[model samples]
Target chain A: MAEGLVIVGGSYAALHMAQGARENGYGEAIRLISDEPWLPYQRPPLSKGFLAGKIERDALALKGEAFYRDNGIEVLLETRVSAIDRQARTVTTAAGANLRYDGLGLALGARPRLLKIAGADLDGVFYLRSLADTLALRERLARPLSIVVIGGGFIGLEVAASLATLGHRVSVVEALERLMARVLPPVLSDFMAQMHRGRGVEVRLSAGVQEIKGDGAGRVASVLCSDGSELAADIVVAGIGVVPETGLAAAAGLACRDGILVDDAARTADPAIVAAGDCVRYPSAFTPDPCRLESVQNASDQGRAAGAALAGKPQAYRAVPWFWSDQYECKLQMAGLSPGHDRLALRGAMAGGRFSLFYFRAGRLVAVDTVNRPGEHLLGRKLLAAGASLTPEQAADESFDLKALLAA
Target chain B: MVIYQLKDGSERRVDVPAGHSVMLGAVQNDLPGIDAECGGCCACGTCHVYVDPAHYGRLPAVEAMEDDLLSGVAAGRQATSRLSCQITMTPALDGLVVRMPERQG
Candidate 1:
């Protein structure tokens, strides 16, 4: 019997692992098991283009059916992996099928954190994570309706911008004083708040959601804030954050922290089984601490690394992490991690609506956040990947040629 | 139809509707080379391509944002380099040729 490679989840990481396995010359059966009914698709557009009705469902697919068939990859859709038997090298599915594998790849992605307040289970309450969620939300957005978004994270802000673009009255409530407080600097956070407010989005800062009240019809009607104010809402969305899915890895006796613990090669303690994407925590030069990333760049890079390792051509995963978010007219591009940064250098004037935030720690360039400035984001990725060093003053100089630094 | 001459010298001709971008044309055809990771948002530079110099000036003028992004391509960028996603397909520009770079960053 020819041994097969079994991969779990239907997100970017799982798809990339399959591609990597093929590219690395793993010729045996390649099986991808996904809980979603559809094939792997891009998720970034779920909040922007899909929500705004600019792209259709077919455009979201990462690979067509012909690609899978031509590549000799079998896809098991709407199937869930119940357990992994490490000793036997087999995985049991929810459909009562036990499949044996020579190698196992776990790309179990994260799930959205739900709001724990009252009326959380109401009909009109939604959380955007999967295609189904986006479809339902898009249906609700067909007509102009008042929307109340809880949390000021990327997902919340993206949804707010999408709903507002659809001509809906949208309000964002952030428990923190500014938007994107955890990832972005104070100045950028303040700028984002002003940008949203300027676009007629009611950005309520330093406000906590007390409860989501439902009408007698059992649909969300209004949101009650901790400040003793009620804001009428036709729909409510909660985008607080996501919790990594690691139950299967832990149940199978794999090492796990907040996520499944993997090495630089994306391999677990059991060499036969490997994990990647948001579900796995690994150390990278980009951050001082071990971290789990939820971006597509991390997923694709780590998935390729895991696949390469499984094919006996292991390569250390050391790519600079990059992410982008589209809100209104601004395209915010970020590269590298900014943890423990001591100083920030602004490349351009913020009033000009195009600038890049260069972060440095101990006078060494660390990360960058660029708004409508793709050149800076790209250069920052290269600089961080090369582990280059530069002073804060040099980074702040407008006449400095960032591309020339890469040549040096 | 928009013609994409890949880095490996293979040719893929895709029928891109007027409103769609050349990146979407390449992506919808599953033509290898264009990643379009941001879904034609012009945020990620994965869809970098070198427009054939003959048809480069005929298309719309490169915006400041697109010019900045093209400057950041991981691979060495040429004077003909332009992000395929920012170039919209039009009937007047039929048979436009774009060559893929060695690799997109």
Candidate 2:
């Protein structure tokens, strides 16, 4: 194993690689180069509790300095890796310092995609992807007024829910045919849309924002949709989604597609480098489809896996993916990938947001989305890992404890 | 009261009580930007901010989770890149300029 590991892009992947490199018995210098200039933090709450004001800022530290010092990891925050010299096995920073690395792991996570509307650049039309965005939104939230959020993805819906709880009039404009169309079932999305609307969020389906009009002062005030309707707002939140941050990788001549292309081993075109997090497209475990995910689980797992591999204990990244989001009082948890599913099996109380839906593909449980049911979600993760096939009867019966099925 | 410079070059004057993390202190006063998601347990790694290297020693010793989280954050974390939640305003960080990370995860 090399005596040093340098990981790039300080999000979940950067943190995991630093820790995993030490744990994997690589008695070497571990360094992380991050562009954000902050500690490795989790993003799940950016759209949930933190946005809702339930969680405070200091509570978000992933770890303190002791972990790095104890583990022999060097972290360079706020340093942007401007260029990766593939031939030299070195990275030059934005500040004009070049560092050599034996192995490199890129956790350069995805970024929120720019909103497709006029006046998106105007003040008050913000995206809910970063701490800064949430903090800025909170400034607008202080007055307890109306908020117009574009997109019905997880972030948008959660932001809508949080603003509604704060007594802000909320409206969500989703260009999608339905909410969470990529991850959720139609029925569940419908249920979720109802819940938000019930809380006074006017969710407009199939409504794409054609143009956003800021006030005379250059602050967002309303959105004009393709449907030729005007939606008023005190502020606009665009959770449209994200694109992988792979400019450095692509510039360095790495294979890039929807994400950096990697095998199960999380390796890029360069054997000396690897990629993880929402920025890489890798083989999926539950099915044949290659997937690129924006979930925290993927970022952490891929970072850890790539870190270990970079340490020469090369193993394919095949961990079951899981993620959780807090919307209002509802804790939505997902286990496995829900792609290519033929039907969804329901358990628990869906109406109250206390149930779960197990997605089955070819009679096998491929993925499960649970709301406020952690126990079932845990088992569902195991089920996905084990490729556990389940009968519909077993799924429909709430009396059928999922853990027991795991044992069987 | 302590004055801290945010990432955006704006100065935030936070009236922190005695013995509160600069991160939490800013948050308590309704500072618009710090989001500490783990309740300051040092887990979840969301409350990351870089302290001015010039004034790092004024802060408290970094704990285990704080270190762990920093390691994972984008490494520009300098001698000053601290989980702001881990920093207590000890009058030493009086004029500290803290910068926020672009994304928590």
Candidate 3:
């Protein structure tokens, strides 16, 4: 009998890999190893619905328990893989158990980049990554408390908005000059800042955290900033960003950079090993260089590609990247990559907080950002995936039917 | 319980609790053919389904956002086309029938 396929890690990437493998007819025994105590669950809602108490814990499950059992996917929860012995084709678990595999998958997702300043580890300072982190933060949010969210990225702004809506005093601090500067242009970033401010969140930009000060009981009391300003806080949440977990791959003698190096088929340098999701930087049609995307779309599509490879049917993954962020009553949807965009066109009324921004690079449609406009956003995904183009004038005109472009 | 009509002339009966969306039923059951990539947030249009004509009207009216999203599904839109995520399961909707598209965009 074959040793079967062994998948390491949990979350969308790992879960989808198992599903994809089974769906593609890889019938050998499948074992999924994860360090998380809980079954693989959705992480996006942790900051929004779950934090707001609108979505229950049971609803977070990606798939029901019976699904895994019925599919013959054995899930080993709370088991950490200490080392990978590529020569033996087995993984050593922390408990001294070695699991053998004919093929291996590295779905090791990213981890939260921690704050390194003094008092960073003090109680009341939290990072949102795992369900455990969110649950702890949720428990802390049971009572109204002053919160200084230390980032203006999507995660930070989202947590701030969720807490503010729950009637908590919230303040957002971003080291950048504008919110989400790394992704969105200044125009959208300004709109985000205004939206947070209108909802009673103090949006502070261009300020870096110097240190976190602890109280007499060793709990976070306030955050000291680089400009000598201090914000009182009963708790602090850092959403700086994430670092791809490439340690396992690197230790196993695989090529690793910012992420584990992988090909279009999510294959590493080793023929028997494949990687996907946030941990692997792979070639994409949308980017001039290999990039690692940390979105649900990337994880699911790339995991599917990895599964196909494991099933001996490797195909180049070409799924278009798309993402969404829900803050307050507004929904921000984005499609495609737009960092090199030289022009932008707007459709719909921005004054009412509902509009779409089209990004163009040298007269070619590259990406789009739609706020409260799901129609354009959805059309944008289809258009981008098809490599279709639109003139700036056509994209700006509200009367222009985007569906016609898709049909064409 | 819900009946999912597949493109291959097959059907899957899944027991989805009331208040959960129709997409969640297929996803949680590990049923193939329905890809709720965005986790039923209506962000991705992958979970497209064609409701059985007789039971179509029994579901809630499509909102503006969902209506706009329906036009862009990978499978060509049908008069009965609806994003499964937009349709919530109700006791009255028990044994509801929804057909998955040949492929999700």
Candidate 4:
């Protein structure tokens, strides 16, 4: 009997799993099923280069089509998996094709949370998530027009920055008092607010969108605020956040919370099935509680772990998590989670726009956020992965060679 | 076209349109060695590459961010080290040669 491997979703995790499985000597037939028609492409550029018209659609592809064919990896594009028969170890496709597999990997990513407000379905209202959304947004950005970006997260801010760079009048309305409140400290948030404002972006914080009002022509005309204010907008982009795609997994009787529940090995409740990427909530040393990460680093690392396990390697997932966001001239790099950090030490002049914030919890270095400081970001990931100990004073001292701490 | 010399001694010459970064060129071609985990934002040092010394001086001066990132290259930094993502391809850089570092941090 010939055993086979079936992978769901077409994203970074799925590609990494296939690569990892091959590297681990999994010579069996590997089939990847994706609902999207295109090959697995990188998503980070969609918010930056793709939106800016600097990168073509073909440039976003992670691997050339020939690579998959040469590797003997079968990719069933535009095909959706309808059901998983755990008892029969088979998966039914949307076209009613039953595919048998010895192991299943779920890289089901996430979808952007849509604005459920009135006039959200208006013609000019948009959400940035898929290639289709980006292509649509790019076309809309062709002519100069007033743009209102809802939400202050990375996607919203990046879109605002790109639009402003392209000479469009941009305004950002954030519901929270500070921008990026969920991930960044108040200080960084304030700095970002100032930066955005300096770039000719009208930033309105602590303001919620009451509703997106449309003109009689079914086009977005203005955004009404909770504070009884309205801002005229030709285009309205909503980027509140994303929710993991877990409906399919839950239907198959897999353990799921906000995301599909998985162990460190990327294995779900059923050993025959494993999951990775944005859709899985897995245990991590970086966080006190199990959490779901929506970053390229998380997807690739977790997928590698799942693939290795599926190949019988069975190693635990322990890769240090890292993330980056580019807005205008600033490049912010973050390493590890800093949820419970009680103290923060600044390593450089914040006014200079080149500094690293060392986050410490109980006098131990836990995480770092670097603004245009890549050396510190890299060393920070290394130190956190190595579990190195450094006091706030040592971190604050510019004379100290942070790289030396990696050896300790 | 920009030429990239891999650590394994293989060379790849990719057609990179102007305004696109050298990292994007390698990435679009699916060339090995450049991880570019941060997607050419100059945040991740995964796209570290050594410019062929002959063409190093002809390239634009290294920016502060690229210099900072080069310091973190896992393969060890050299005077020619540059984050390929930061170097935009131009007509003058027609024969530009970049060598991939042994490893990218």
Predicted chain B of candidate 4, TM-score versus the true chain B: 0.96
Better of 2 and 4 by lDDT: 4
Summarize candidate 4's per-residue lDDT along A183-258 as a digit string, tens digits: 8999999999999999999999999899988888999999999999999999999999999999889999999999
- Chain B TM-score for the candidates in order: 0.95, 0.79, 0.96, 0.96
Per-candidate Cα RMSD to the true structure, in Å, reads 1.6, 11.3, 1.8, 1.7
lDDT of each: 0.89, 0.76, 0.90, 0.90
Clashing pairs in 3: none
> Which tens-of-lDDT digit does each residue in A45-70 have in candidate 1?
99998888887776687866767888
Ranking by lDDT: 3, 4, 1, 2
Which candidate number maximizes DockQ? 4
Query: Which candidate should be chosen as best, given TM-score against the real structure?
Result: 1
Task: Report the poorest 10 consecutive residues by lDDT, candidate 2 chain A.
Answer: A58-67
What is candidate 3's local distance difference test score? 0.90
Error of 3 at A356 (Å): 1.4
Pairs of colliding residues, candidate 4: none
lDDT of 4 by residue, B12-59 (tens): 888899887899888777788998887777788899999999999979
Q: TM-score of predicted model 2?
A: 0.79
Per-residue lDDT of A140 in model 1: 79
Worst 10 residues of 3 chain A by lDDT: A399-408
List model 2 lDDT by residue over A1-408, tens digit each: 453778887777788877666668778788888776467665666777677786666655566555566677788888888899989999899899988888988888877889866898888878776667777777777787778888898888888888788888889999888999988889888888888877778989998789889888988888899989998877888888898988989999998888999988888878889999889999877668688888777877788788878877877788888766667666677888886899888886776667889888877778888776654665677677777768767887888766565567
In candidate 3, stretches whose alpha carbon ends up further than 4 angstroms from where it belongs are B53-58
